[model samples]
Target: MTQATLSADRSDANANANAGAAAGALRRIGAHLAPWLAPLAILLAWEFAARSGVLSTRVLPEPLAVVKAAWSLIQSGEMWADVKVSTWRAVSGFTIGGGIGLVLGLATGLFKPAEIALDSTVQMVRNIPALAMIPLVILWFGIEEQAKVFLVALGVFFPIYVNTFHGVRSVDANLGRARKARRRRRPARHPHHVSGRASAAVEERAAKRDARPRPQCPRRCARRAR
Candidate 1:
């Protein structure tokens, strides 16, 4: 083939490859954005309805209006103050609830007597809705920060308790057997060493449970290879 013809063919091939790459990138972008399409459409419809007077501002304000109000609150420092108070209440509640739950869960999971005494009561309380206690909470704590904190604590308590109890209970039976065997072999060994080993095993199990495999993007991988 002539050199000019060969060069022309090479340029055409390069252009085709570039176009294919741009198309692939667009497809990937569209795929990523697909999940947001419905929400975006809804927002657009809401905005159009509000502007067209189909929806009353009194009943439902425009999204832009809400954004503006939030911005105003932020500028006035009211938003940050409210956020600080709310964060404090939530953290206080979670700390109080989570501490009790962890201690009780460990006790009940490890000792049969503690389980028999506490588990039934805890299960019964867990079945009761947090809303059910609202009247009593109001009467006892009144309309103060304490009431809000108590409600938060009540909401936080059960999940922590249940998860901790189950996690401790779910420790491998083989590990427990191994611990016992080790104690029998070495009668003079410190008890803390065995307990530390058990704790390590629990931590390892939790780490494994929380370790998730990240998904690879094919486009990114192909680009990296090139």
Candidate 2:
């Protein structure tokens, strides 16, 4: 076969193989979503119940009713304003508290002196329930946006801090072995493989060596050729 034709055939094969692989991946993902079918069925049942008044409309609104309410809010622009406020509060709070937690976690994980200085206070604060802190939070920040942001930040901080601390501390123990195992399983290199230019140079040198006339004893030289 011509080199160009052979290359075209190989390219087509590779494209087909990639398309098959993608199809198989999508099928597997669809299969994994089968577990979600039960939850979907339950949601349908809940809507049916709400529509038939088997469930009190006051206690639990119909799904359609909720959707309509949300749609109305959106049409009125109230939803957008509320979303903006909530988003601002959540993002600001998370950024402030998460940053602090990350820094503290890193410091405590790495340095004994920092741990000794800060860990006790953090643990004590973490143990106190958020509800219990509301009165104090109100006293400090008052009933304002600051109070809401502070409360959200406080709620978000401990989990991030604890998880980060543990992850940092256990990283060598957990991830180090996995890293080594992956390295060990890497495919072996081809012993005969060489770059195109190098292989060409090697072939040229061998051709020259073979073509060169070697000086030999006069008796042996003709016999060797024969």
Clashing pairs in 2: none
Clashes of each: 0, 0
- How much is the lDDT of residue 34 in candidate 2? 90
State each model's C-alpha RMSD to the native.
Answer: 22.8, 14.0
TM-scores of all predicted structures: 0.75, 0.59
Tens-digit per-residue lDDT, 94-143, candidate 2: 99889889999999988889989998999999999889999999999999
Model 1: CA > 4 A from native:
179-226
lDDT of 1 by residue, 100-181 (tens): 8999999999999999999999999999877899999999999999999998888888999999999999999899899989
Relative to the true structure, candidate 1 reaches a TM of 0.75
**Highest-TM-score candidate:** 1
Residue 179 accuracy (lDDT) in model 1: 93
Report lDDT (CA) for all predictions: 0.94, 0.90
What lDDT is reached at residue 42 by model 2? Answer: 89
- Model 1 poorest 10 in a row by lDDT: 184-193
